[model samples]
Target: MTASTEGATDTAATTDSGPTSLDTGSETGHQTTAGGDTDGSKPDLGAAPDEHCANPGPWPLPEAPLLELPRFVAHSYIDLDQIGWMTKFRSSVGHDYSDAFERCRSMKHYAYPIDEVDWGAVELYAPVAGEVIVVEQERYGSRVQLRSTLHPEIDFVLFHVDLMGPLAPGATIAAGELLGTHYGDQTYSDIAAATTVDGAWRLISWFELMTDDLLAVLQARGGISSPSDIIITQAERDAMALCCTNGQFDDPEELSDWVPLDAGNLAQPTRLGLATLDDDDGRLR
Candidate 1:
């Protein structure tokens, strides 16, 4: 939960200095799912090649997780862009890089689910089975830090939520189990995942962990057109410099610092999994 936070939730105030050091995964020769990804020809996410990781992730977890959350604008960045989070950002003080680049980390992991059901009426469920290791109280709500049994190194959390019932350390939860509702009467929402990779903290997109079947379910419901809907790679974000420096959009010509998702008028779908290509020649791309 964030203290005095509005849109997205976080306990610690993020600094430009960065959290310890973010492992962009560039060093691991981070595996991409498809051959086209190797040449940057395909936009995809690499599966952490494990015999089986359920979901492999090493995003940073606070020695304790630990901010006012930004007034959330929308469900997914795509919808926020396609649909809009206008009411919140219009009244913005500093969220979404509106202020002095305060908490990019929060933004990095922040996700407003795009499910069409009534948000207020819906009960939040655990995306995967795990144990409630710690529940941190934030001004916006409770941050349930769930350590996945399937992927022990990865920690999952649904920010700004009120659990269906009380939970304590070691309390077990199964996938799709009722966690709770978004913190009572909350205006904004988000879900975040993290893990310690290379003994360092890295924030990851929660969508990366969902099974293919689960993703298919969401796709069929029109919640997400594709896995790429909610994913933005660290390498991609840095290359785009998605946020403003020192919190200032600074550019007189630009009204906001956020990069428009459809700025490229993409004809091909951006995806998070690798694609195997068939080639007559030896070219990887």
Candidate 2:
């Protein structure tokens, strides 16, 4: 599907800490068109994807309540190769397949499933503590972008979502603060995060960062661990390997703040970065 924009009022909010920083030293430039629509008429900053899924695996609904931590699923690059997480497609029907995939990869688009039975507009919370920088509206849709003050180079953009109650292009928002919700039959929303590097916006993979964060929290959520248990399953390793690709990540061990599954009986090492949103004074530790 295509992207459009709508109008919104500006507001302000406090910021929080996540690994929101980006390597701003790259030479590529990124731009988002007004109304969040980019077509053949505009210069190609990069082709953005529709969604990112971070859920480790699906859960039986009746048993979901028994799960300690929330399961993550967002828009992610579809692994056509079936061998790893990164996209290896080199050709398509007629378009520049490799180029398009790379562009989509760079954007790190996130798509989460909406409850079809009760899926309508609901409030969106600030994923980070940051200030509103740009609110763009077009004839068909709208977008709001935020820049984390704590990590000035990191930016978050919510697409096809409306703003409500006096929000606009210059507001500051606290992490988990309310933003308006979807107003139509759409099943999902899109969120794109990037960091400005060398004057260009570089997208970071949200899967590793998000999954690792959830792992940290879940490790402490329940009392279900054995001193000799194998923490990192082979499936989890493949998923992590797939989620991180290109120059984005060479080794999962090198990923920042990542908690290794096997750490020699280190009790809940992942929880090291777990912190409450209200505890804004501390970083995700």
lDDT against the true structure, each candidate: 0.38, 0.33
Model 1 poorest ten-residue lDDT run: 276-285
In the range 188-269, model 1's lDDT, one tens digit per residue, is 4445455543343444545555556655644554535654555543344334432222222222212221222333422322
Error of 2 at 127 (Å): 0.8
* lDDT of each residue in 1-285, candidate 2, tens digit only: 111111110111223432232221111213333333355344433322211323111111011011122223222221111111111111010111011012212232322222232223445556666788766652223556776656555666665555666677568987667677643333234455554333323344333334444434424533213311212322232233222221122123222222223334233222121111111110100
Residue 116 error, candidate 1, Å = 9.4
What value does the lDDT take at residue 229 in candidate 2? Answer: 27
Candidate 2: where are CA atoms >4 Å away? 1-101, 104-106, 112-115, 138-141, 211-285
- Prediction 1 TM-score vs. true: 0.49
- Using all chains and alpha carbons, the TM-scores for the candidates as numbered come to 0.49, 0.41
